[model samples]
Target: MQGAPGKRIAWLPTLVAKRQDTLRAGHLRFAREAPWSGVLHCFVLDCSGSMLGGQRLALAKGLLIALFDRAGASRAEAALVCFGGAGADLRFGPAVPRWWNERWLRPVGGGGGTPLASGVRQAAQVLELSARRKPAQQRWLWILTDGRSSDQPVRPRHADEVVFVDFERAAIRLGRCRTLADAWGAALFAPDELIA
Candidate 1:
């Protein structure tokens, strides 16, 4: 602590040292880095044909950009799992995005059937791996979809929190997103609700 500049001072350690004897720079303790730094935000996006009908996929992409920006600002780790066209795949990372921009999401095309279960399973694997790597870190699972798929996968056990961002805006609502959120005991919000 004597010459450790730019480090946050541990006030408790400093106070204890002051009470013990005359304050000395050697007795001061600088706070160690945070256990996990920030949360791991794993986003599972649906790139099904249905999402393209009303520009839902585009909206989801916009949200992803905003979220990525926020994650960068918060120094949080992020990962992306895209599901559609028969499978799911990880697109981003478990590491912090040092450089994030909307251009990165531009090439994410959308079409085909929604493989909701596949997406959840893929994201679950990512979350499990992250949990093993950083046990102290909080894990948040975010599913951005239109509730167009019939697949209802079990919630990932490792996720500390879950959020379903429903993009469904059809006249005949499926409400699957709400149901899934309810079943998982997670938060449910519409795309508009999130911005509002």
Candidate 2:
């Protein structure tokens, strides 16, 4: 009773009774075993021309590097996907960044049409592959974009949780990030919130 809720034990008599009468099924185990062990932090960054102005891309890159630091501190696996123009690239990894640095993120260039859908689709594939290898790992998708793209909202299939970071700045916003977040029922955050 003094441990985590996940560590609680129950007789589960009904579950045992559901089994056929046999010596092998006679044991009554009580300890609860949660399936998840840790989380995989997946970052999907939009590097479109729209983000080039106002240093949005630079902000996103900075935020991503910081997030990798946080993930490393938490002992979580980290991955990166950058999208622009026509497609998405799995730029970094679906692995932990043992030696992470600004150099690793410096090469992510931006300036083209926003392929937000492609980014989400590619991240979904990465998450799916990781899910197969680590069945108990929770996957968290972090999307950083200016939300200026015309691409339709695409919800990732394998992500256990999704967060959309909107970078759009203008008198009248497109709100594409909010739309995508709503489509996936994900949490939304502004670029300014990166500090907190």
Candidate 3:
């Protein structure tokens, strides 16, 4: 899926299809299990300008859809939050089981600046609210970003678990993400490692 830098973006339909297939299979494996009573997985995606290149946003959307399918099969609830251009928005819902889907996720065009702090803060709030409603539910926060933002949150105190998936290419240096992950005691995974 490599492309010349600065060229107009091209949509890769095949890749999207393949991603959906893989995720569907993964979800099928979990479908046999008894439904978890109370659990929510929140996927926070970075929709900043930096994600426009390398089809990062496309891949992320695919991953989110896949995750939703898998979580649903496991009988877990899910939600979505997207942040970019100085603000964060809760695009999807705190829907349980069948409520999550690709249709809920809007295609976010990349431009302006990255508001990383806004995204993180909003995600934490979502988790906090969920915890209040369903204290027994296990909450997981999965953050996908290139880690190119200049702003950062003080620290998140709400999530039961946080995982940072850095999509930045190998040539680029990961600034603040490692530190942020360390501070939050969150698991950190890179794109290369995840796809491998």
Candidate 4:
């Protein structure tokens, strides 16, 4: 119906039935009934030295703002985490839909070695704490980084969902990060795809 044969199918009863059952028995109904109270999205940003080049940090900031706007429109909660130099800093909050904004996400001056392990550890801690406070809320962690760090910690055990946005170019060779992401069972995306 939408485009070509690959784009649409006239008879998809099995698939539709499966989707309906999933909606009825899974989190979909719950999410729809109480959207604002049902989910929390955490944006974990890497402010390491590598991000200083190519206006990456600026782009990240803009993306964060856009994410906040989208989350707000959907009545979801959001938080911000910046990691690099020293460690991960919980910059914004476990803030509600209305409170998230650019002011909470100021440009973090960067100039030191990347400490990805510390940042991941801190993000896991924050997520754990948030879970404790709001057990019913579904959690989503979005990690944006160049995947250049060598000292990243063991992947967090408590992440309900995790997405890694790789800022590295296609010409660059894969590093430990690909292994790390695979081990963590997180979805990996390219920065160009996400930001552009």
Best of the candidates, lDDT: 1
Candidate models: Cα lDDT each: 0.84, 0.78, 0.70, 0.68
After superposition, the stretches of candidate 2 with alpha carbons farther than 4 Å from their true spots are 1-36
TM-score of candidate 1 versus the correct structure, residues matched by position: 0.81
Taking all chains together, each candidate's TM-score versus the true structure is 0.81, 0.81, 0.75, 0.76
- lDDT ranking from best candidate downward: 1, 2, 3, 4
Residue 65 local lDDT, model 1:
86
**Which regions of candidate 4 deviate over 4 angstroms?**
1-37, 97-99
Between prediction 2 and prediction 4, the one with superior TM-score is 2
The sequence of per-residue lDDT tens digits that candidate 1 reaches over residues 64-168 is 888787777777899999999989999999879879888888999999999999999999999999889888887889999999998989999999778889999
Residue 132 error, candidate 1, Å: 0.5
Off by over 4 Å in 3: 1-37, 97-99, 192-196
Best by TM-score: 1
Error of 1 at 190 (Å): 0.8
Model 3 score (lDDT): 0.70
lDDT of 3 by residue, 1-196 (tens): 2323322321222232233245432222111121344667788888988888888888777777777887777567787889888799887767764866666666566676789889888888888888888876767788889888877676566676677877776475766677788887776776544452
Question: Between candidates 1 and 4, which one is better according to TM-score?
Answer: 1
| Model 4, position 11: C-alpha lDDT score | 24
- Which regions of candidate 1 are displaced past 4 Å? 1-37
Compared with the true structure, what per-residue lDDT tens digits does model 4 show for residues 16-126? 223324433222111223344466778888888887787777777777787778777766678888888877888776766586667766756666778888788878887
